[model samples]
Target: MSSKLEQKIAEFRITFIAEFNDKLAVLTKLWSNARTSQSLEAVKKFRFEVHSLKGSSGALNFLTLSNRLGIIEEKIAPCEEQINSLKTVIPFIDRHMNSMNEASRNTPNSLLVLQEAASLLGELRDPQKNKEEITPQSYRDIKIALIDDNENTSAVNAKLLAGFGFTINQFNSIEQLEKVLQKNTYNLVLIDTDNSTNPSEKMFAFAVKLRTFDTDVFILSSSSSFENRLSAVRSKVNEYLLKPVNITTLVSKIRKNFKIDLIRPYRILLLDDQALVGSFYKTLLEDEHVEVLAISKADAIMTELESFHPDVFLLDMHMPNISGLEVARLLRQQAKYDYVPIIFLTSDDNIKTKLEVLECGADDVISKSTPPNIIVQQVDSRIQRGQEIRYLASRDSLTGVLNHGQIMDAAAHSLRLSKRQEKPAVVVMIDLDHFKGVNDKYGHLGGDKVLVSLGQLLLQSVRDTDYVGRYGGEEFMVVFSNATPRVIESKMNNILTAFLHINYTVDKQSFNCSFSAGLASSTDHEKLSELISSADAALYQAKDAGRSQICVDVLNK
Candidate 1:
């Protein structure tokens, strides 16, 4: 097995041991209560606890513990009638607890006992019977609006979008599009500035108007004039496509902007002993589209952290055995969990107490009596801020694409994933044609504008699964997932042609620029370094052939 797989198994073992200890503790308490009071309620509680433990143990592959719990459960299956007989099962429960404690300590004898116990339990039931089935969610209908003066163009665009399960409404003019926007909301709006009869300023104004409604807007234009591109930026256009847009690229952009391909549910871990209070908090957060896992046992923290990987931890100020502060300190000691957000939920409103909680490694402390809405807002804000900080760290300062080191790291990771999954990927290296002329003639500011435009273009042009990065000054690298050589060549060609239309003005004179690109796919090489070297060789070939063209690396086997 690979080291990665071995590490994952080790992590699972740690979590399982912790959770088993917690379950054992709970069972011990319930067993003691049942022994003292031979009532039907006590018997029912004991049986239920044993049944839960049996299920958890089996799932975690602790067959010995599971089998022992199963025997105890079977002894109490008669319910109230077996209440008085439950005392006879106390020895078995105690033995199981002892075994679990030894297992937690990684004792060889306990491990041998567990293996023997598992062999005995093999006759009870199929171990795989408890595996859960996962069902895929159905896709929702997406509504899109297309605005263009040309009927043919609008119809073609609408038809293509419709094929992707989008309900498209085509408008022949900006006036018609505006009228529909007022009455209905759309997931996306595609405007063709070149096909519009309205002037450039008027088209930009309409885009600005659409932004007010918080709808994702994409511009399809044949013109990439500096003025028009700058206007699109100011109008907050989500994507700008050069005229005669590539249908595949357009769909990819729409999916990315609307998060159609990203269904990331925010995961939250709630640590509280108060069952009722924990339920309330879970329900409130779930209503806001958050996935919450609540654990009353403080010892089970490691288990939930490993499984759920929560974005934020909602920890109670006080928990039995382990206080929230102590738990926070323990978590801080672990390198993997050092940066995770821990918000203390407490009823104590004393300022001194809140400060003390913060000192104990809490990111924030909130009163339990605070309104649910405010609590949700605080949690959501903190998660969002954390995401933004992470995003900024990985991105280039000027272009918002991945920085040089990040891009290389991303490429290496992607290559490993592709190799494991047996999927194909393409790497395209791009260099601006006559970029030094732009800097020398139009000045460095003009060059910066060109770089920013290309950055935005690359970002908007690729699929969400693809990675775009600023490799260096005027060079960019794009890693396209699950793409073939043909696809990479076609896409890069489209981008190159579109780039030529981007006009920049210096003084009263206007100029345009283009880019040369080289493509290398998974078929060409297995290693990321080899792929990059192949693409770089191709890029040099493109530069030698002409300044504005794309060359595919043909590796001789």
Candidate 2:
């Protein structure tokens, strides 16, 4: 593998150095056009050559020649003010090309040219290079407590939440829950109640006590009377869910309240009119584990680009019919891709043209002759930062997971692809049983720890191709591409078990938690909303059937 990579690198280096003189000749011709007609296109074309040669020359240890070429790149910058400067610089470029070619292959006659280029660089690059500045920038398992005097309900709820990426513990009494709270924390707590006209004093007292711990407390009653509601408020209960609970509503609340930062694979779009060059570059990038879509034509790219949805655009600075500048402008005009970064791999060195490209909505520009290592680093760093920016804007801050809108957007995208490919897709809706009880007993801070924990767990546990996001409160949505119900069921089981075993602590006290999940596949519903609704319905079934389990919509049907 190492040898193969080395061989590829060696061949790439040679190819990287190919067409040097030919490019230099092109630069000379463009220089003439720029000098005579003051043509910006000529300078734009000129950069395609000199900028590449500049890097190649520098890479081969020819500093003076490279720097000299660099000067011409700046001179031909597509600016009206600098267009006239080309005439004077043309002679400079001419003499250096001659001097560079005349020099012995082994020893460069660079001492004089190097000094002159150094002087030119000092005048050109100072106080004007500010392109790579991005202003600064995980999910954890959620722990929950289901406090119900009824063993059946509490146990079932605990297991239900556990299946969905929450760690839940069932306590039959507030006293039992208090002992766990003393040492362990929970993000939510659920107190089960009956439809009696008068509130149970003991249950109300426990709810108030749990509030002191800063946990989110909820009372689940079989009644929704005003008196019952007022009693909950007076008891300091955080929320009141009428039984039988709509599991989807409860899960949505959880998702909205908690956060998780999920990871998804990012890809790049490479636009180079040169098919061979684009192919080789694509291969090089792929070897580094970068996903890239390389295109040689500027026409008919919008649709492909829309579907590809690249994180970064790698473009050749100039093309024949439609220049890179025009393409960049077109991309900027679209709201959908406004945040994606555009980087030009060009031979143009004109400071003006660089600024022009920037104005066209590009992120950065690099010479094509840059070392592969540096180029790779450049692409990687930009992708990382661009993704960070993109995700931050759409994710829940604490958990770093997609928020409702973002997750739904992901769902819509998946639906489109799955429908097109005629492949299966799945949506899993998860909820924690008696979640408010966990929050109430553990206090808000402890509750937060649980949410963060659950968020991190889903992100780390799921496949890179999967999408994890908080649908609301403690409820989460996971969308799997090209996956069957069986696949989802197996995946959910592992996540549930993992949550069930996570030991949580508050003030050195320890406890555990669990969750429940409901999964629906594309076979059940073709529309995005219908699919989610189906999964949500299945979630209710899981809770009804007893928590800490997963319910499949198709299987039930």
Each candidate structure's TM-score, on Cα atoms with residue i matched to residue i, is: 0.46, 0.58
lDDT of 2 by residue, 34-64 (tens): 6567677766666666655564454333466
After superposition on all CA atoms, what RMSD does each candidate show versus the true structure? Answer: 16.7, 14.4
Q: What does candidate 1's lDDT look like per residue over 146-248, in tens digits?
A: 8878887787777655543468888888888777677899767888877456898887788888878867788888877888789899989888889676665
Worst 10 residues of 2 by lDDT: 130-139
Looking at model 2, residue 406 earns an lDDT score of 82
TM-score computed on alpha carbons, candidate 2: 0.58
The regions of model 1 sitting more than 4 angstroms off are 1-372
Global CA lDDT computed for model 1: 0.70
